[model samples]
Target: MATLTHRRIPGRVRDMPSDFPQVPVQDNETSLDGPREAKAFLYKFSQAVEESDWKSFEGLFAEQCWWKDHLTLTFDKRTIQGRQGISSAWQSLAPQRKPRGFSIAGPGIEMVETPPAFVRMTPQMATLDIPFAFSVSRPDCACVGIAKAIPSASSWKIWVLTTSVVSLKEYPFQPLPRAVTSNDLISPEQRGKATPQGLPHFQEALDAVVIGGGCSGLSNLIMLDSIGANVACFDLGSPGEAWLQRYRSVRLHHPNFMIQLPKYPVPADIASTHLNGAELAQYMSRAVQDLKLPLFAGVKVTSNVFDQERRLWTVSLEEVQSGQTSTVQTRNIIISHGFYFNEDCPVIPEGLKDRGKFSGPVQHTTQFSTTDLYEGKRTVIVGSGNSAHDIAKFLGDNAAVQSVTMLQRSPTAVFDFDTFHPFITALYQGNIPVDTADFLFSQLPLGILRDWMGGAIAELVKSSEKLYSKLEAKGYLIDRKPNFIQRVYEDRVRSIYFDAAGAFDLVLRDRIKIAHGTVVGFTENGLIVKDAETEAERILEADGVVLATGYAKTDLPKQWAKSGFLDAESALQIENMGMPAVDVEGEMIGQVTRSGHPQLYFSGYIFSAARSFSRFVAIQIMADINGQAPEHGLP
Candidate 1:
């Protein structure tokens, strides 16, 4: 194994941009009515913070105020209530832990007024649209802080502060160079005349043919390659293209440690809290390259036939870009194409398929990107999943959007990100290594974990009655079942949304309308949605419709058959393979057929955490190829 030198990037803070736009002001104004007072308060606050005047800072906040930190200042998640608690938390910082310098400036300020019924704090609060910078000298790291202020007793105080490390942009962690020597990567000349196996093969007979090139596929390939297996990976698009194709704003809800690729730990310095789509894609590509895995990008598998007598799989591959084709033989096949291979749009009832009559664009959520194109249009986003909420929030935030509505046919389980943040922080942020944390987390049985999480969620809901009550009053359906995690387990689908992304707040504010109904059909100018309870139909006028209905569970064998990758008989055999049943040793029970589908495997489609599950899957694959028991139970 090769190692890279650890370097800490320097941190710095800068003033907010002068021309930055402020948040739109609300109708009510109490204390700190305008930007003038807010600006003065911010200046004084920054000065006191720089001077380490905990006493002065403590005096600014009310006796009972909320302070939330998201991966800023502390490199951990923290929610401190009450001025004394906040002061104690700050005062407890190590002597050497003070930021080198901190400054604040902003585009402007706006006053946000919350209903007295919604919060225990003052109803009227001033929110400064300030940009802040924090730097530490010892570690040489810097970050940009997006800070806001609210009215406390007699003056304005810091309410919410969110930070993103600035150094990750300039200094990202790079994977080690390719491990394969010259002889390891077979040359085209060598491949042309190679006939190690009697069957027709491209390059050579591979130990395994791994399909798909997303996070799961790449992780499996890396592990197999490390174990010296002759494996080749194939994908219809570029490696990591699945992640690259997500919406621009899509980000992993899990923390850094939870989502690391197999064998490759995400360096702590490279934005080590969360990753957006682009960052994740880059990391996947690097992992593939660093492992020197044989990845055939832009190649699609066209046919696969199992030869029972030979105990081998004859596979045909087609180059998607060019019309070229080839063949290969493999001892094993691993389907890593993900669970949601098929997009699931709502079933349009009879008489609703008049495509020529509808005037606007209708597309699945996968096809929808930023809201730049829908500027003056009234858009209706269908569904209540994470994507739906994200899209709705994006559209609601866009000033140019005439109107945005989210149509939810059923209740969705939504939890605030804060509920899980502290636990994740405790598990992965401090002394605990990611592998150790993952091992400890996996040690708990699925049912036990679900029950524990249910209790925690119940407590969280009870504690946040004000917030939940507000959501319910706004007509948003909230699931009152076994909490979010248990509900997810029961449904076998990720039907939960993290509420910290501002979507729930927007719904409550009526900035994003929520319509509870099933979409019956589309009219010439809009959609006909029927209420579930009343069965009353209402026309929702929209210039565009986004179907955030999610994807169908992919039947791998059936998909392969439809795509001409498997013969009818073999496809039927696999179709009947039924629900995946795993033995105690983590091997698939009854997955292989009499026709010699040597260890046809399914992975990466479970409801648990994908990264952790993929790690176990890779181990299982390695164990199967090497004829050893898996170190851990099946994924």
Candidate 2:
């Protein structure tokens, strides 16, 4: 909250044209003693802290540096941005937290899977990245940190340092034994429904209330339960309803092996190349039920008030079908409503130039279930986004439809699955363990990752050039944001169409046409649209229009204010809460889990973050409620 800033990493800048190898390489791999030197640097760092030598500790960092701490010393995921901030944090929180026994995380030079420490070059800078592990003894926790160093004054000076609390010592997330007997998996029988012990309805107060029973909320519940915190999730529909209600052709592109909830792998029997939305929903619901996770199905939060005196929230809930209302109490609230949600109705467009002259049916993507309903009907999809393309594919593939066209307001970045697979899919696919894949990604902060991702994306785009060239030749406009990571910042999900050859093949084959224009007005049986590039106005005849323009971001603060869910102080604490943390240049640096208010955590995250890092969110809430991480936690 103090300042929003940017510090460009020194090297072959991504998003800029460069002939040098995109992969940062050490000047001399054989000559570099990276592991030994990095270990020595870490030793000095530990010694300085142990001796309470503030000057020596300050000297360990570069002038421009960052320290991202995730509940290690600070209960919040905070980025201390400078040497001053870093030194001040260490001075204030170190003695009390008592972090010690620092050592290299793994077999530094020999290991390949766990991402060992190394030295790499950027043409201008030689950087040493060392991943280390340490023990936090005050409350008893296991933590890890990675320090990026550059040689300055003939010594390695760290520029970026990340310290994360992996887990608490008492409530350890022990992995199930690799070789186990049938007796190890057996469990005692439960009484009524298979659900975690908590308020079945709105019968009693709770420690945590997770709104949105989808993956995000469910994942958070798992973590909260692991930490021994009483938590429950609420959804507007029954489990898997959100996914099952999506259009019939909805299928996820993510690798199935990497998409499972924590400690709950998708069943082997239902595995496929692409996970169907309905299948995923069923699996998630079944997983929750089997795990005994508490979920209040078919219920939604109507309103709530945060009690400052009691440090609790009294939430109003209503059953969708029964029209029954109830109140539940909670000390902490996590709004894990997720990035993409299924709404009962589509987003009604507000400002169409014409007033009620169109005779054609207008449907939102949410309302369109099947192409069978529009037999022999001409359809115009209003957006060139992922949903628009999917709808176009369905209409084009259906033999009954006369024609299907996509009216684009702006150029869309589309990459076929084969080309885009290497960057995202390949990482998760091969024999690499899921944890190792995740650990490799967790090694660097997103900002630095963005710098490197541009290179990988650039290489992939070379293979996708033909795909783009052919589309542009067919009148479809295309644009590529420098880094795909920025897409996550702007869209919360991958906005670029990972064209899976169904809709894309149709478009390229001319079965489905693409138009570059905006719908300005409507005709009696069609739409009057304006060309984006030129001032030409045109008419697209259609029997119906599907608004795949997507929905607006949820303004939770406004809704909360209107419904008295938060006080002025807490409202300000969480003001502008949900969104990835970005630098001044608008490059996403990190994902935010804090709202300035420690107890009121926001976990409305992307799919991967929601599934992988929900534990971090849960532990923070646990810290707040149990006083492990205070409201005014470490800086």
Candidate 3:
């Protein structure tokens, strides 16, 4: 790699406060690497903080620096800009004045290549833990601090600092107290025979039974098995079957680091940067085998019934191939079926209801196999989310396809993936570990985080003004309000697309036509779409129509009730709990609901960027089963 030198422009220097403590300057022209300099700087900085030497602490920062406080040290989020601002903020929010004294501990320092920067220090701190019943009330609780600095003429001057707290139990990568012995390395049969003293052994009646064998379900199984719980997992198909069934071209939208599974991460050799569907399935398969989880594959869960008197769930299972039936009783049941449990295809318009009337075939996005099916023909794709955009681009670029048109009901919030690559790299790459980045990113409150993201979106739109203008010129509608994250959280649907692919460029160049309308009815050739602006109906010519309008909310609780898996009252209780039942503490709302359904739990329902949220769900489930659930009201 070539080294780039950064020229520092001369700037005005602020005078030190008269009351601040003065320290002797270190040697100016010493030769030290980034890590060495960072460690030396932290030593002085920590000493200054411990002694309450505000002047020495303030002197270490550059004239223009930023200090960001996540939810760890401060109850509210803050970004203090400039040396003066940072000094004032720290003075006002002095740690010594608070009930607990703050101290820096276990700092990990690394070098950054860009901006001619040298050291980036990430230190772990010890402080009072959050006042949750499940939390350990230790004086030395773990937290994280990040500091960045550049080599100045005199010495290394700090430029940016950030801090946040981490949950030991929630983060799966963190080591647990349990000791793994040689027996833990034994075969599944031997391990099953040697049970923990308190926990029940694996048998027909299990302590817990998790449904689904995909990423989410597998995550739960890993956590449960780690705690020596006699747990069993069942799925309709094989492990990672959903990913195997996806289109061949489908790669994970997020980077590999973001999609990693807790406890069992994707191996470094297997495309550590990004993973296709098949690759992800392969990783999950290995994880299932390595964990020695009791997984019943190719088994369909026919029904689940809760026995009120026994406080146990009796689940009816059937072998898909042989049609053989069996049953199992478990104390706790976790419905880990993912959000996309069923495909939702809109009813065919009244005009095209008759098969004889329409020549072309109409199908849902799920039924779509490959582009070869629509070769040398025109195709219309409905909706404007990621899937719709991907399908439109695929059809448009196909050599045989005559043309591709996208029918979007409303404007979509689209931004180039490159626009956020720097941010993503900073969070997931370099000195900071992905898990630490995840913890810090989740520290801010939702409302505050949304406001910050909204600002970022505005700046991004301004930066890509010309590209957006081209999109607008080509009749594409863009929505900027609420930002992407807010929209995803509010509506379960993913309404934004990260333009890592060439979909945006295709739309701009008219390779794919964008039609802003709603399908009121359908015609034989294509479909009749009503324009949003003019309210005029137009006929679009196409050989087939793909409905990418997203999945229907079948109400899992209601379906479970109808199947006799849960009582009508319990189902209603879960239904009223809303999607995922997330509380303010970021825990699922009903780990132990007000009704106290101890054996009932849910997973794979929350919308979070960090795939590790599944791990937190598993932790809460384990806590609940072990009678360690926090005794608090719903957040």
- Using all chains and alpha carbons, the TM-scores for the candidates as numbered come to 0.63, 0.84, 0.70
Lowest lDDT sum, 10 consecutive residues, model 3, at 125-134
Q: How close is candidate 3 to the true structure, as a TM-score?
A: 0.70
User: Per-residue lDDT for 59 in model 1?
Assistant: 78
Better of 2 and 3 by TM-score: 2
Q: Write down the RMSD of all candidates, one decimal each.
A: 18.3, 5.7, 11.5
Tens-digit lDDT track of model 2 for 1-635: 11112222222223322122123444555587778888889999989988889899999998777776666776545556668878888888877788888877654311123433554544444567777888776567877777778776567888878777777776665342122233221122221122223224435567788888777788787777656666677777666676777778888777677677776777888867667878887787777666766677777788657776877788787877777777888887787775334253245555453436776667788888888766777888888878888778878888898888898887777778777766676557746656545655555555566666776677677877877788888888777555566666655443468776378788878889987777877787788888777879888888877888776556545555765656555665563533334544232333334354545666655556665467777665655555555333452
* Candidates, ranked, TM-score: 2, 3, 1
Off by over 4 Å in 2: 1-28, 31-38, 62-64, 82-84, 107-115, 119-128, 150-155, 174-204, 339-357, 430-436, 481-483, 493-495, 563-573, 577-593, 596-598, 631-635
- lDDT per residue (tens digit) for residues 1-635 in model 3: 00011211111111111111122333532243444555566677666665767788888787766665432333223445567767666655555222133333332411111112232121221111111111121212234455655445676566556554333234333332234454332235432111111222334566678887777777666666665555677777766667666656676766666666656557877864667777887777776666556666777777777777876778787777677778888777776766433543233444445545557757666777578777877888878887888878778778798788888888888878788566545566525555555654554434335555666678777887778788889888887663454344434545777776679878877889988788876677778888778999998777887777766545666666787756676676553333332333222233222223445655554322324444444444444555544332111
Alpha carbon lDDT at 260, candidate 1: 76
**Candidate 3 residue pairs in backbone clash:** 304-565, 376-400
lDDT of 1: 0.56
How many clashes in candidate 3?
2
Best by lDDT: 2
Judged by TM-score relative to the true structure, which candidate is superior, 1 or 2?
2
Write model 1 residue lDDT over 374-418, tens digit each, in one string.
Answer: 789899988888888888887889889889998888887777778
Candidate 3 structure lDDT: 0.56
Model 3, residue 25: distance off in Å is 22
At residue 625, give the lDDT of candidate 2. 55
